[model samples]
Target: MGLMALVTLGEWAAKVGRAETAVRNHLAAAPGFPAPKGTRPRTGKGTPYEEYDEAELDEFLKAWEAAHAPARYQVPGDPDEMRTLGAIAKLLGVDGKSVTQYRAAIDEHAAHEDRGARRYYRTGDVVEVLNSRKGFGVALDPTRDRRRTATASEPGS
Candidate 1:
């Protein structure tokens, strides 16, 4: 029989630029993909090793490249301006209403609110708010936290 090489999930994941878990998931879903031959190190309990001859590895590499190739058609122009509220909303994976509410909250609490028909916010600010408020939906306002802490510590709070 021809010689077969064995590779671990870690090696495959590294070659494909994916996490080990993702490699396991893909292997599970693709029955046609090469199956694990045996445990690694060939002595004690270890992760299952997938059998790969030179031809199989080349086939896998070609398939991976084709799957990840960028789309042929590209957008006509540069994407929408980053400072626009709509663009910010898209980047943050939120709707216009959420962006508006965040802007309003910042304006109300801020020392000076910009006055214009089309108010613009820095992309950095929107990203910061989105990342900071991901779980609790509360802006990372140190002053607000201090006030709550002081109030709770008071005798009648």
Candidate 2:
């Protein structure tokens, strides 16, 4: 997992849209689940948590997501796609300030710029950064009152 992203079990739970207990329960029966690569130390005051390889998690998720057409959050066309900070913010459904605050914390951090004077980052890098945070994984717009909750009517129901 050289320089790649490692996220805690909590983040994995968020990624799968399940509670941590659900994840723990599933793990017992699902040997295919990615094993924890290691643990990441807390920045402030908290117990360190089990960290798993993010790429492995993605691979596992892709297979499960196949039947659920049009995922709640669309994966980028290219994981290596270059995007500016504003674009990353939109992708994560977060304010620019929040992303900027965590930008430096991203693993293997680097900033690229084209002649247009805009800073760009790799899509994967941004995801790594977001997964490291305590309050990320779920893209909730703070200013919105209601999230999209209605599923499509079942084929002419």
lDDT by residue for model 1 over 57-123, one digit each (tens)?
5476566545644323222233322365665666555677766655655444323324476655555
Q: Mind giving the per-residue lDDT tens digits that candidate 2 earns over 1-157? A: 2787877766765566544554566552465788778876765766666688878887876654453332233335576888876787787677777667655554246445564776677777676656544332223332241432322221111
Question: For every model shown, what is its TM-score relative to the native structure?
Answer: 0.38, 0.35
For candidate 2, the lDDT comes to 0.58
**If candidate 1 were superposed on the true structure by all CA atoms, what would the RMSD be?**
15.4
Off by over 4 Å in 1: 1-3, 41-51, 68-73, 77-157
For this target, which candidate reaches the highest lDDT against the unseen true structure? 2
lDDT (Cα atoms) of all candidates against the true structure:
0.47, 0.58
RMSD values, in order shown: 15.4, 17.0
